[model samples]
Target: MAAVETMVRVGKAAHGRGVFAKRAIRKGTLVGLVQGKVIDDAEYYSDYCIDLGGTLSLEPKTPFCYLNHCCEPNCQLLLTEKRNKDGSLAPSTVHVKTLRGIKLGEELTIDYAWDSVKPLRCLCGAASCRGWIVAVNHVFDKSTAY
Candidate 1:
């Protein structure tokens, strides 16, 4: 929700809806901040929740919640934390950044690399698609070997 209004738009994607670049974006550009509320329990975790470190999670608002995954992704999630005056961690913020130069109209994507209990089949269509929405190390596990 913190993305510049003119910089991105939502459109049709292979998995339903996806975020798309509204203009050419250079590598390392700060695409947008993912604004959301902290999810305090695992039972509330949804597919849209972003893992904050390993213990915390965030459920981001629109635009960010619509980002889809691709094996050969052009973007990545960046987590930033500010320290509180007492030396404790403040709530972290997630930023989306371009991993490579992205052309205008290209769907913005990140590798989900989910370590799910029940992985879903991927339809990203990337040449190097891992086929399942799981972490790279788990992609070849005998139970779900690709």
Candidate 2:
């Protein structure tokens, strides 16, 4: 395994500045915790394009926020649920891991369906890639497991 380090910088992917995995990540493992500067939803909205998979205000530290939403992602974002104002779930610590043995220089992304109803479009160019990224619950017929 490579040393735990910030191997990638926050920059533009399909969406925005998404950090990618620098090396192969094992299954059922922990990636970096998504702790970063607290970004207000209002501020993020003002700055960003405001897509379906944007501004996951779970704990301001969830890996889900860092893991850009991909239609054919190799990672999964598991959320520790907590009740929100409208009886909805909020993420505590979003755990990101490889769904399989991801190759080096690959972007570490996850399906945002665990939280969003419908996500944004993805242009990752995977063979089985879906045209758009949607939430697990609100996933479309073309929605596939990464």
Candidate 3:
């Protein structure tokens, strides 16, 4: 809540649509909320969806849905709890935050670790690019080769 607004814009990425910073963003600043409808984990693979926790998922409703995966990402997803109108604690929701200072026009990304059900070819172009976007455990294990 560092007086920051939706400092992001959706644009073409190397793979597909991606979120880009509209202005410089300081590290640890809240970019925006990930609005979505709560759904069961069975529907997790649907478009714009993220796992909330065990057996639950969120189908993103905002432009954050355009966010793509990167091995070296500039942003991260965090869960936060807020009070409801009745002063009861609501279910935790995911928020996007900067991991470090991001320059204007830089694409916003997150390490989609351990969440992907199947291995995917990575086009993130990071120096440490793992070639494929898969769970960390599968990265170095030859048995689970990407």
Among the numbered candidates, top lDDT falls to: 1
- lDDT tens string, model 1, 1-146? 33556788988887689999899888889888889888766566688788875457899888889999889999999989867799976668899989999999999999888887677778899898987888888744546534
lDDT to native, each model? 0.83, 0.54, 0.79
Report the Cα lDDT for candidate 3.
Answer: 0.79
Where is model 1 more than 4 Å wrong at Cα? 1-3, 139-146
lDDT of 3 at 38: 79
Off by over 4 Å in 3: 2-6, 41-44, 81-90, 115-117, 139-146
- In model 3, the Cα lDDT at residue 67 comes to 90
Q: Which candidate would rank higher by lDDT, 1 or 2?
A: 1
lDDT for each residue of candidate 2 in 1-146, tens digit (9 for 90 to 100): 23336443454566555766666667666665545453437435422122323354533333235557666777765555556799864435544556876666667776554433344556767776655565444645444334
Cα lDDT for residue 108, model 3? 94
Sort the predicted structures by lDDT, highest score first.
1, 3, 2
**Per-residue CA lDDT of candidate 3, range 54-90, in tens?**
5667888647888998989999999876567999655
Candidate order, TM-score descending: 1, 3, 2
Clashes of each: 0, 4, 0
For each candidate in turn, the TM-score is: 0.88, 0.56, 0.80
- As for candidate 1, its clashing pairs are none
State residue 30's C-alpha deviation in candidate 3, in Å: 0.7
| Candidate 1 whole-model C-alpha lDDT, 0 to 1 | 0.83
